[model samples]
Target: MTTDLVERVRHRLAGESRGTDPIALAEAVRAEAGGALSHDAVLAAVRQARDEFVGAGPLAPLLEDDTITDVLVTAPDEVWTDGPLGLSQTTIRFPDEDAVRRLAQRLALAAGRRLDDAQPYVDGWLPARQGRIRVHAVLPPIAANGTCLSLRVLRPVTHDLAALQAHGCIDATALSILQAILKHRLAFLVTGGTGAGKTTLLSALLGAVAPTERIVCVEDAGELRPTHPQFVSLVARPANVEGAGAVELPELVRQALRMRPDRLVVGEVRGAEVCSLLNAMNTGHDGGACPLTELIRVFLQVRRVAASFPCHAFSG
Candidate 1:
């Protein structure tokens, strides 16, 4: 079968220092099959092998759809995607649990993270050139139902307030309020639940900022693509398998302060970075903003405590 031929080709090319060359894969396919497969079959096998080794085997097409925001794989046969229309099941299915595991490992490896028995989970961004992709994978025992992979395809789009209104993300009154907030350079937070439009709204609002002002954003994932000439972002990095070469959010926030940013933004607040960000905002880092989703209730409580302060403590 095609899968068997792809496996043989993979073994032949294993450890070879070559990219996904069509010529190499074709030769390997012919040699593996001893000329039994026709030219068309050989081409098909080459594509399959290339996908298996270097690409997102079955999920490439799904990722290519810019409208899709999330791709979830809970089981070997269960795949789902969420987008503007909301969550929906997909027909894409892996051949087996082994195939699913292979894909999860490969994607984690592509993201420069290791996923094995020792490190059963990986949180990183997928290595891609066209757009941003955030990847998270959990292996067996932890996953409980085979390898689970979550792919967040961060679409690159410039959404202004008008565009957001057109998308029904906000109404006229809310848009006016947001415009007023930005006009006054207010420090604020956008709180919402999972799959909420926090990132989208933040990006749109940031995009509407004054062009002369510099916007520097810090995020664990590089999801914000505001259409501003002075927009610069610092994304956090996870520690490697050896537990080194990691960049945390708090450090990035401190670094951003030194960048002389006119507008300071954090994609999300999740850890000790909250202190750093609070210091930055309270110390006259005007036009500061970020979204909050994780620990929503706790963040709300923190926001309440912050609001009780004397002056300019993260006002809504």
Candidate 2:
């Protein structure tokens, strides 16, 4: 099919159709052409339109692939993905930089964020029925190139310690040490570089805790999916465009302290919440797991027998 025909159908739909239903779209396609479009053309137009209206536009198929762990967009023509085999380029390309910017803005809006020149970056999550996507997008000047979009895909599968060991994320010796840490209710921290499976290891460790113990998790984006029976999670909220009704991690940590959490888990410690979390663990919130990046200096100041595990493995 020609691009002009698709463009015509899209223009018609923009005026007539507000929904992405294939049947309605097909009817509109045929009606816009006065019943001239063939079945193949109509089907093609509907599929393309549906893709545009649905999740992640052209990147929806890649997101749906369970094997893919990360998807990156550096330019309209440069797209990369990370899977079990590792980072590799794919054939997917955007129509232009404007198309890439449009998709980024749309996704940011879906995540209840703003992505424009004034606020050129957004860190948020796109929640799905089966999995969640952590979206980090930056505009040109901040990105130092074109618009850069990074997506970290977290599927809804619980990785226990055994699963981690099986996947080579941790050896049997490391698994035993982790089990003993939980058994003794030792407060521990996991640190690593970007995409180093810190969150995955933390989730698995929390999943190993006793079912009766209450586990409360606080995160900027709700990405942790542990398979424990007793689990509670609190997610931070960004301020609206008017800069009102913002909830940060420190406040959430203070609230979690009152909830009688046997294991208070901080998904990632980045700022002021470090004080609140230290107070919690100091006062007797044993069996705590904190995952962070380049925040060990803060942990060093607090005198505690907490174990620090640096995760370097990347298992998709």
Best by lDDT: 1
For model 2, residues 1-316, the per-residue Cα lDDT tens digits are: 3455556766776787456677877876777667777889788767766655567988887898989989999998999999999999999988678778878988999988899999999988898755888999999898887899998887865778898888888987898898899898888888888778888888888888999999999988787889999999999988876678899999999999999999899888876787788778767677888887775665563333233313311111
- Checking candidate 1 for backbone clashes, the offending pairs are none
TM-score of each: 0.89, 0.83
Q: Any idea what lDDT model 1 has?
A: 0.85
For candidate 1, the TM-score is 0.89
Residue-by-residue lDDT tens digits, candidate 1, 1-316: 4567667778887756555788988888888999899989888777667767877878998998878888999997899999989889999877778888888999988888999999999988875655878889999899887889999887666788999899888899999999999999988888889767888889999999999999999998888998889999899988886889999998999999999999899888877788788778788888899898866665775676567556655665
> What is the number of residue pairs that collide in model 2?
0
Deviation of model 2 at 67, angstroms: 1.1
Clashes of each: 0, 0
